[model samples]
Target: MNLLEYLNQNYLMLVPALWVLGFALKQTPAIPNWMIIWVLLFVSITVGSLTFGFSYEGLINGITAAGVAVLGHQMVKQALLGSGSRKK
Candidate 1:
C-alpha cells in the first residue's frame, strides 16, 4: 500500500510545507531549539483543522503530516551523515 494512503491528499502537501517552516524556524534566533517540534505540531493541527474543518480526520492528518515531515528529514540526514558510531 502507498504509505501516503494513510493521509488525505491535501495533507500530503503539508509535509514539505512543514519542512520549509521548520527550516525557517531553525534560522530564526528568536525561536528556541526545543520548541520547533511543538511549533510544527501546533501549525500542523491548526492548518489541518482549518483545511478540513475540526474533526477526527483533521486531527489525525495533522499528526501524521508532522510525523512524515520529521521522518523524511531524518531519513535524508541519516543517509548523508551515516551512523554516529564507526565500525571497529
Candidate 2:
C-alpha cells in the first residue's frame, strides 16, 4: 500500500497510541487527538477511499516504535523528577 493508504488503515490504532505517549510525557506534547482525527478524516477522504489488504508488519512496527518512544520519555521524566527531589 502507498503512504496515504497505509496511514488510513492504521491511523485508528495510531492516534490513541500517540495520545498515550503524550499522556506519559506529562509535560508538553504535540499531536493531540484532535489533530489525529483531522489527519484520519483527510486520509479517509483522499487516500482511504481505496481499500487494501492488511499488514501485520506495518501494524507491529508502528505500535512498537510508538510504545518504545513513550517508555523512553517516561523513563527520562522519572529520572529528571527524581533527581530534583530532597530527601528527609
Candidate 3:
C-alpha cells in the first residue's frame, strides 16, 4: 500500500492520463503554448506527489512523464500535419 508499490502497479495508467490531460489543455486558446507546457508539468508533478505520496522519486517521475507527453504531442502534430517540412 506504499507509494512506490502503488506507482509500480499503476504507472501505465497514470502516465497516459497525464498525457491526455496535457493534450486536451493544448486545445484551449485561453493560455499560451509555453504556459500550457509549464502548467502540464506542474500538474504532473503535483498529481504524482499528491496521489502517490510526496517523494523525490515521485517528482522525477512526474517530470519524466510530462516530458514524454510533450514529446509525443509534438511528434504527432508534426507527423499528421507535415509541419516538419518547409517550402521555399
Candidate 4:
C-alpha cells in the first residue's frame, strides 16, 4: 500500500500520538517553550513526509496535526490550571 493510504487509515492514531508527544515536550525544562513548538512543527512535517512519500498534502497535514496538538495542549492547560496562573 502507498503512504497516503496508510496515513488515511492511521491518522486517527498518528495525530493524537504526535500531539501527546508535543505536550510532553512542553513539560521538559531543557528546551525553551518556543523551541518546543518549532520542534513539534518540524517533527510533524518531517515524519509525515517521510512516512507518506513526501508531498504537499503531507506537509499540510503535518502542519495541521502539529497545530491541533499545540492548541489542544494550550486548551487543556488553560482549562485545568486557569489562565491567570503563570508557570514561571
**What tens digits encode model 4's per-residue C-alpha lDDT throughout 8-88?**
543445567877777688788888877987988898888878887688778777777777667777778789988579767
Off by over 4 Å in 1: 1-3, 84-88
Clashing pairs in 3: none
TM-score of 1: 0.87
> For every model shown, what is its TM-score relative to the native structure?
0.87, 0.37, 0.73, 0.72
Candidate order, TM-score descending: 1, 3, 4, 2
Of candidates 4 and 3, the better by TM-score: 3
lDDT against the true structure, per candidate, is 0.91, 0.46, 0.72, 0.72
Q: Candidate 2 vs candidate 3: which has greater TM-score?
A: 3
* Residue 53 CA displacement from its true place in model 4, Å: 2.0
Q: Candidate 2 residues 1-88, lDDT tens each?
A: 2333434444445445554645653443566644543443343333222333335654444544454434555567788989667577
Residue by residue across 3-87, what tens digits does model 3's lDDT show? 3333444344556787777768778888787788798889888877888878887887777767766777777878898945867
Q: What's the C-alpha lDDT at position 21 in model 2?
A: 40
Per-residue lDDT of 66-88 in model 1, one digit per residue for the tens?
Answer: 98898888788789888774577
Better of 1 and 2 by lDDT: 1
Name the top TM-score candidate: 1
TM-score of 4: 0.72
